[model samples]
Target chain A: MGAAGIGGGTVNLYSWLSQFFGDPDRRHGPDSIVHRVGEHLLFSGEALGWALLLAVPLGLLLGYTGKAAGLVTALSGAARALPTLGLVTLAVLLAGVGDTAVLVPLVALAAPVLLVAACEGVRSTDPDLRDAARGIGLTHRQVLWQVCIPWALPALLAGLRTAAVQVIATATVASYVGLGGLGSYVVGGLATRDFAQTIGGALLVVLLAVATQLLFALLIRYALPAGLRRARD
Target chain B: MIRFDGAAKRHPDGTLAVEGLDLTVPAGRTTVLVGPSGCGKTTILRMVNRMVEPTAGRVLLDGTDVAQLDAAKLRRGIGYVIQQAGLFPHRRVIDNVATVPYLLGWDRKRARTRASELLELVGLPPETARRYPFQLSGGQQQRVGVARALAADPPLLLMDEPFSAVDPVVRSGLQDELLRLQAELNKTVLFVTHDIEEAVRLGDQIVVLREHGRIAQVADPATLLAAPADEQVAAFLGRDRGLRGLALRPAEGIVLLAANTPLDGWTLAVDQEGRPTGWQRSAETIRQVAVFRPGLDTLRTALDSAVLSPARVAVAVDHAGRVIGLAPRAAVLDALDAAGPDTAAGITATGVADGR
Candidate 1:
C-alpha cells in the first residue's frame, strides 16, 4: 500500500469509532471486537507470563545474592538500547516468520523491565529489615520470600504493568507477518486501503494499553500489604 | 556462657578490625564493650553472632562453636538490636515483634497473641500494637525493637549502641527499662556503646577496648573505674571518672536526714502530694529540689542532687515521689569513704554491688 493511497482514502474518524466501539451490528455485531481484543490480550499476556517466569525470579535472585546486580543493570541497559522493530523483523527472517521468531523478540523486549524491577526491589529493601529478618532466624530463602519480595512487591508490580503495556503496544507489528492479533486489522486494512479499519485497529491497541495500565494499578493496590495499602495524606 | 578464644577479624583489605583475644561473657549478666569510635568494639560484638567472622580461633556459645551452626539458625537463637531500633517499616508494630515467632512456625493467632503480650511488656500502649513503626516516636520504636528481640525469648541479646541514638533523657529512660527487664528476664546481654557513663550504668562487666580491639580493661564497672589497665584506658573513660564512678555505687549507704529538719537554714518545701517542690529558705523558693531514692538511685545522683542544692543537701524520695529525707554532701562523701578508697575496684570489692 502506498502513502498516496492512504492519503487519498476517506478517513472518517467518527465512522471508524462507531464501527469499532459504538455501533452494534456493524462492529460488536459479530463480536469481532471481542475476538481481536482477546487475540491482542492473549499475545501480550503470553509475553508477560514468559517474562515473569524467566526474569522476575532471576532478578530477585540477583538482588538477594547481589553479586549479579551489576549484570542485571548492564543487561537492562543493553536491552533498552535494542531496536524493537529491527529485532522483530530480523527475528522473523532468522526464525522463518512464525511464533518462534515473534515470541523470542517479544520476550526479549519485555523481560528486561521485569528483571530490572526485581533487582531494584531486592536492592532497595531496608538494610535494617534484612538484618532483623536474618537476626530473627529467617533462613535466606525465607528472607527473600517473606521479607524482601513482599517489600519489593510495589516495584515488581509496576514492572509487570510496564512490560505488559509495552508488549501490547509493540504487538501491532506482529500482524505485518499475517499473525492473528489486532495488528492484523492494521495490516489487512492498509493492504485494501480500508483507512477506517487501520485507524480503528491503532486506536484499539491504545485502548488496550490504557486498560492494561489500569488493570495493573488494581493489581498493585490489592497486592500491597495491608499497612501500605492505605494511601498517605 | 559465651567464650571468645583468640577470636579476630582481618578484613579483605588487610585491616585488622579486631585483634585476637580470649574472653568469656558470663550468662545472665550484661557484658559491655565500650570504647572510642574505630576501637573495634562493634567488631568484637558482631563476632559473637558470626556477623563478622573471626579469621583466627573460634567463638563458642555454651561450649558449641558458633561457626559450626547455620548462620540463620545461630542468628535466630540470638537477639540482635541495632541503633535506631531497625523495626520493619512495612509491618505493624505487633507483626514486627512477632517476626521471629512467625519464622519459627508459630500460627498467626499464637504469634499475634505473644506479640501483643510483648508490646505490653515493653511498655508500649496497647493501641500501638496495630500501628506501623514510623507512627511511633524514636523512643517507642526502640521499645518495639527490644520487644522484637525478646520475641523468640533468645537467651542472649547483642545490642550495638541501641540507646545511643536517642536524646539523653530518653536514652536514660530506655537504659532504666533495660535494667529493669534484665532483673526479671536475666538474659545475657552484650551491649556496645562509646559512652562510658552508659557502660558504667548498664554493664555488670565492662570490656574497655582500645584500637584494634585491644582489651584495655576487663572488669566490673567498679573495678574498671577504680583501676583502668593503663592511661589509655583511663583516658577513654573520660575526664569525669570521679563523677561517673559514683554512678556504679548505690545511694543506699548514705545516711538520710529526716525531712522535718532544716539544713543550713534551707527547708524542703513539699507540694500537696508530698512530692518535693523545691528548697525554701526563710524568704522564698531558692531551687528546685533534686531528690534521689536511697535504695533505687545511684550515689552519683545522690551526690548530684546535694551538689546542685544551694544548701548542699540532696532530698531523698520514696517511690511515690514524696520527700522521705535529705542526704548531705558530706554524708555522701563519707559513704564513699566508708565503701573504701575512691578506686572503683575497692568500692566494688567492698560490696557496693550493682547489676543491670
Candidate 2:
C-alpha cells in the first residue's frame, strides 16, 4: 500500500479510516493501531504525572504564601511562548533519541499550565472567605487544607484538563525521537510516502485530546462539593 | 471584661492606627467603638481576639493577657462577625454555623444539633440549614454569620459593623434581632462601627473615637447624644441628637387619658374592633392616624405619633394592637420630663461643655 498508492499517483482517504478503526492484519501486536494508541496515552500520562508532581505543590505553596507571584506569572508566560517541537528536537540532539528526550519537552509543555492553574486556583478564592477562615479559629495549615485547597480544586482540575489535552496532542512528537506512539504512524508513513497512515495518525491524536477533555469535565462536575459547584457559575 | 491597657498599634510603615490607649470593655454588655473611616476602631476590635497584636502594651481578657494565649485558641473562644458576613460559600448554612463547634472537636451530630439551635436563635427557619450561603438573601447571610459566631457559645463577641451592609429596613430588623439576642445572651460584646446612629441604637456604652483611635467621648447612648464632649463630638453626634436621645428612653410612665376624653374640637373615631380609624373634626375626617404602644414603643415614636395625629393626641395601643387609651402631646412632654435623670444629666453635660 505504501509504494503502490504513492507511485500510482493517488491517495486513498477511505483506506486510512479503516486502519484507524482497527488494523486487521496487525491486530494484537505492538505495530497495531491499538498498541500505538496505548503508547500515546502512556507517554502523555508519564509526562503529566511528573508535571503534576513537580508543579501542583509548588504552585499551591506560592499561592498559599502569596509569595513570588510575579515570578510564577513570568515563568508561565515564558513557558507558554516556548516551542514544544523545537525543545523536543533540541533534547533529542543533546541526549540522543529515547523516551527521556520525548518526555522532557512534553513535561515542559504541561508543567507551566498546571503551575499557573494551581497558583491561580488558590489565589482566586474570595479574600473574605480567607479572612473568615483565619478569624474563625482555623490554624494556618488548617485554613489551607479545609478552605483554600477545597476552593481551588475546580480551577486546578480545569488546569489539569487543559494540560492533559495539550500533552496528549503533543506526545505525537515522541515518534520523531524514536519513541513508540501514534506519531510513529505519521512519521513512518511520510518516510514511505503512505498518506493514509499519516492522516490516520493525526486523527488519532485529535480523538485522544477530545477524550481527555471529557474525562476532566466529568471529574470537575462530580468531584466538587455541591456548594462549590453552585458558587462557580 | 476586656481591658486595653495602654494597648497600641503602629504599623510598619509608621502609621499609628491606635495610640497608647487604656479602656475597659465591661462584661455582659455591648461596648461599641465608633468613629469615621481610618479611625482605627476596627484595629481596636481585633485586639481582643488577638487578630491584631498590639505593638506596645497589652490587651487582657478577663485579666488574662490575650497576647500570651495562642492566637487560634484565643480566637476560637471569641465570636466574630464582620460587615459582609464572611460566611464560607463552599459550606452549607448548617456547616458554616457549625464551624466553631467543629473546630472545638465536636462530633458531626452534636455540632449540627448545636448549629440547628443557633440557626433558630438567629431567627432562621429550619429549612435554611441545608441551603448554601449563596442561596440566601444578604440579611439572611448576616443572620447565619451571627449564628456561626455563636456556635461554640463564646462569652465574647467582636462585631465590626455587622449590620451595616444591609438596607435601612433590614438594618433596623437586624438591630432589633441583636437587641433581642443580647438581652438573652449578654455576651461581652465589643462592636465597631462608622455609623453613630447604629452606635446609639446598639451600644450600652459608646466610645466615640477621633483620628488614631483617640477617644472623643465615652458615655451611654443617651448621655452621648445629650452631652457630647465637645464641638467635634457634637458635630459628630449630628444636629437632631436631642430628638435622638428620646429614642433611647421608652414611653413608659406616661399618663394616658381615657379614650372617651374629647378634646376641644377633634374627636377620635374607632372601628368595631376598638382600633383607631381616624380623627374626625366636625364633618371633616383625617384618615392618617398615627399610634404608639406605650408599653413597648420609645418616646421618639410616642412623640412622633402625637405630632402626626390631627387630634394632637397619640393613640396608645395594647399588645393586641387595639386602641387602649389616648395620650396628649402635653402628656408625652411630661413623660419626657419624668425621664428626669436623662434631662438633668443633659443639662449638666451642657454646663460641663460650657465650663470647658
Candidate 3:
C-alpha cells in the first residue's frame, strides 16, 4: 500500500504493491488482500465450473451439427453489450437470495464466451481429419470423441482462458450483496473513504487476472498436442 | 473377389455420380479404376468400404453385400488409403501405423511391434516411427499411410489416389513400394487414380472409366496399350503407348555390346568393383551415366538409358551395379520386336531416330 511515510518519506505505488504482496500488516493482514483473493477465486471458480458444465456440451453439439452457430455469433455480440452489474441486480431481484444470486449473473457473463469459442473450435477442425477418421472405420461417436474433440482442444482451451478471466473479474460484484470477496474491500473502502484499501484490492484482482492469463498460456504451451504446437512454432 | 452388380449413386440434388457400374475385381490382384475427375472412380472405391453406399443395386465383397455388413466392422477388416494420406496429425508415425491393430484390440506392445515392422516393410527408416506425421516428408508420410492401412493385414485394400500428391520421383518410389508390398503380402487391392501413367504402372487389371462410372475397358497394362477398346480409350492411352508398353516387358532378352567398344568417341568408365562411375572421353569424365539392370529392369528403362547415355548406348549392369555390358539404341529398339505386332510396327513406323 502507498502508506503515508512517517515524518519524511512518501510511499509510492511500488510500496503499495510490495505491501500488498509481502507485509502481513494493514492490506496484507488476515481477511485482507490474500484472504479476499482466495474468496474471489472460489466464487469465480464455482461460477466458471457451472458455466462450463452447462455450455460446453451444448456448444459442441451446436458446432458439430452446424445448427444455431449463427445465433451464437449474434448472441455473443449481444452478450458484450449487456452490463454485468445490471444483470447481477436483475438476477438478485428475481432469484431473491444468496450464493445462487451471485452465481446466476456470473455464469451468464461467462458461458456465452466459452460456448462460442468451443462451437467455433470444433466446427473448424480439419475436414480431412474427420474424413480420415470416418474412412478408417471409427464409429460416428468415436470420430467425435477421438478425433473431433482432441483436434478442437486449442479452441476449447482458448474459450476457457477467456471465460476464466471474465468470471474472475465479474465475481467481485458478489461483494455488493455483503459477500466476502476481494470486491468487499473495494465496496467497503469506498464507503469508509479508505482509498488505499480500494487500490490494494483492485491491484490484487488485476494480479489474479494476469496469473490466470499466464496459466492458460502455459496450458497452451505444454498441454497442446505436439503437432499443433509445431504449427505455433 | 469383389463385385459391383449394377451399383449406382445419385445424389439428392439429382446429379448421378455413378450409373449402373458393374465390375468384378479379382482376388490377389491390383485392380485400378482410372478416369478423369467425375468419372466415379473414388465413388466406386468407397462403395466397397461402404463409406458411400450405392443408391441402387449392390456392391459385394466376397459374395457378401457390403451394405449388409456393419460399416465399422467392415472398414476394420478392409484397409483404406486416400490422397495426402489422410493421416491423423495427432498420432506419431508408429501409432498411426498401429491404428488398425489398436482398433482391433491388439495389446499395445504387439500393435507397436507390428507397426515398427510395417514401417520397415514400407522402406521407411526405423527412426521415422517415433516422429509425428507433420515431421515427415510427403513421401515418408504416404509410406506411414500405407503402413497404417496394412496394420491389420486386411485381405482387401482400397487406395484412392494414394501417390498423386507427391512429386513424380517420390510418386514412382511409392508406387514401387506398393508393388513390392503387394507381391509379398498379396492383399487384393482396388486402387483408384486419375493419372493414366500411374494406372498403367500400378494396375494389374486396369479398369478404364468414362463419365458416370461407365467402364470403357478392363485389361492388363500390356493388353490395354496394345489394343485399346475405342478411339476415346486410345486417345486417353496416348499416341505413344506402344513405346510405353515396353515398360512392362523385361529387358532380359536384349543383347548388349562389350563396354570397351567406343561410340561417339566416348568410352564407358568403371570403378574397381565394376560399378559404373561415368563415361570417359579423352580427358573429360561425364558425371551422368544412365545405366540399367538387364535382368531386372523393364525394356523401356534400357531404351531410356541408351537414349540418355552420351556414348549412344545404354550400359547394362547386374544387380550389384557391376557393369554387365552395353546396349546400342538400335539393339534396344529391336528388342521391342519381341513384344509382338505393336512393338514391331512401332519400330517400323517411327524407326530409330524418333525411338531415341
Candidate 4:
C-alpha cells in the first residue's frame, strides 16, 4: 500500500512539474525548483524546532513525576487520536489560521509519544544504581538530575526522533486549514481537479518525512553517549 | 566509647528484633556482635547509627545519646559499611569514597584528594580511582566501600557483615585489612556477623545473641570459647569450640628453654641454669614448646605443654629462661585425671588456673 501510494504521488508530481513550468516543450526554469525546495526546508525546520523545544521537557516532567503522569498521558492520547483535519480546524479556530495553528497541534500530537517514551526509559533504570546513589550520600534531587536523567538520555532522544517525524508529516496537513504548507498544492489540485498538483504535494510530504528521520538519526548518532550509541552500532 | 543501654526494638508488625540489651563497646578495639539470622545482631549495629531506632532505650556515643543528634549528621560521623558494598554505580571509585566528605562540605578538590588517599590506605591502587563500581570485581568494590566509609575519619565504625558477600579468600583479605586499620587508627568499632569463627578471630569482646533476639553470652573471645554461658551458647559457637579455644590461650609467660648443648637421639635433656629440657631434632619436629616462668606459668599451660609434646614431658624453667625441673606427662595426666569427670569444672578451673 505504501509503495503504491508513493507511485501514484510520483505520477502526479511529474505532471505538475511539466505543466507548471510551461511543459517539457520549453526549457525548465530554476526559480520554481528553488521555490519548492525552499518551502519544504522552511516548513521542516519550523516543525522540528518546535517539537524538540516542547517535547523534551514535557517528556522529562511526565517521566519524573508520578502524580502528573497519568493526566499528561491522557491528554497526549486525546490529542493524538483526534483526526488531523479536526485538530487543524480546532487550531485554526483558536490561533486564527497561521503558523501558530499549524505548530500548536503538531507539538500536541508529538509531545505524548516522547513523554511516554521518556517516562518508561527513566522508570526502567536499574534499582541498584538508585540505591547506590543514595548510599553514596547524593541528595534525591542530585540523583534525579545527575544519575537518572543522563542515564535515560538515549531513550529520551529516540522518542524525540519519533515525535519529530510525526510532526513533519502532520505539519503538511496545516495547508488544508489555510496555513499554506506543502499541503496547499495538494488541496488546491483537488479543488481544481489537477492531479499533478495533488501528486506533487503528496510526494513532498513523503520526502519530508524521510529527510527528517535521517536528520534526527544523525543527531542521535552524535548526541548520545558513546556507550549508548555503541549498543545501536 | 559506644554503649547500648536497655536497647530494644520491635517492628510495627510486632516482631521483636532486639530485646532489652546493654552493651559497652570499648574504644580502640573490635567488638563483634554475632548471632543467627533474626537474632538482632545487625539491628544492634544499625541502632548505633540510628539506622534502626531502639524502641525502648538510648544508644549512646561516647556519653551523648544518638537519638538527639540529627540522623544524617549522626550517620556522617559514624562510618557504616554494609554487606553488598553499596557503591554508587555511576560514580567513579574516588567519587564514591568522597561521598561523606563531600556531604560534610569539603571542597571538591580536597574531597577527591582524600578519597584517593583512602583508596591507597585500603590497599587499592590509585588507578582504581577512575573506574566505576560495576567495572571492578566484587572484592575491589568492597574495598572501595570500606574506603568510602572511612572517608570522613569517623571515630566510630559500624560494619554489618561487610565481608560476608565476598569469596572466602577475599573475605580473609578484607578481614586482615580491617585488623591492620584497627591497630593503626584505634577507632571504636562495632562489627556484626553470623560466623562464629569470624567472631573468634576478630573480636576483643564477643556478644553472642540467640534466635529471637536474646543475649546468650557476652564475654571476651577466650572466656566465651572456654566457658559458654549455656548449652545454647555452646551450640551457637559450633562443635569446634575446643579448637577455637587454642587461639585464645595467652602466650605470655609460656615456657621456652634454650638448649645448653647438643645432645644425640635423646628426647629429654637438661638445659643451662639447671632446668630440665625437652629437645627435638629441630623446631619443626617439636610439636609444642612449654614456657616456664618462675612462679607464673599456669598448670593448664604445664599440662597442655606436656600433652602436646612428642616427648610427653614439660620442662619447668626459671625466670632466666633456663630449665629447672621436669613435669612428666604422667604427672600432668594425673592432674587432669584428678579434675573429675565434670568438663565444665575442668574448664572453669583452667580459667582460674591461669589466674582468671
**Candidate 2: clashing pairs of residues:** none
- Comparison by DockQ, 2 against 4, better one: 2
- Stretches of candidate 4 off by over 4 Å are A1-86, A91-104, A114-132, A180-233, B5-8, B12-14, B19-21, B53-56, B248-356
iRMS (Å) per candidate: 2.5, 1.0, 1.2, 4.0
Model 3 chain B: ten consecutive residues of lowest lDDT: B347-356
Cα lDDT tens digits for candidate 2, B1-356: 98889999999999999998788888898888899999999999988887898999899999999888999998899999998898887889999999998999999999999999999999999999999998999999999999999999999999988988999999999999999999999998899999999998888888989998898887877788877889999999898888988887788888898887888788888889988888887898888788889868888999999999877888899877788888999999998887685543322322111121
lDDT (Cα, tens digit) per residue for candidate 1, span B6-45? 9989999998988887788889999888989999988888
Off by over 4 Å in 1: A1-12, A19-31, A94-98, A226-233, B256-258, B262-265, B271-274, B344-356
Task: Put down candidate 2 lDDT per residue, A1-233, tens digits, no spaces.
Answer: 73245433323466566655555644677878778888999999999999999999999989999899889989999999889889988998898888889989999999999999889889887888888778889999988888988889998999999999999999988988778799998898787777677878888889889989999899998988888898768
Q: Please identify model 3 stretches exceeding 4 Å from their true place.
A: A1-30, B256-272, B275-288, B308-313, B327-330, B343-356
After best superposition, candidate 4 residue B93: deviation in angstroms? 1.8
Query: What are the per-residue Cα lDDT tens digits for candidate 4 across A106-131?
Result: 76677677777767666656665565
CA-lDDT, candidates in order: 0.82, 0.87, 0.83, 0.71
Shift in Å, residue A24, candidate 4:
15
| lDDT (10s digit) by residue, model 4, range B178-269 | 88888888887889999988987788778888865577777777678777888888888888676456444432333333333333443544
Lowest lDDT sum, 10 consecutive residues, model 3 chain A, at: A1-10
Candidate 3 structure quality by residue, lDDT tens digits, B107-199: 999999999999999999999988988899999988888888889999999999999899999998899899889899988899999999998
DockQ rank order = 2, 3, 1, 4
Stretches off by above 4 angstroms in model 2 are: A2-11, A19-22, A89-98, B341-356
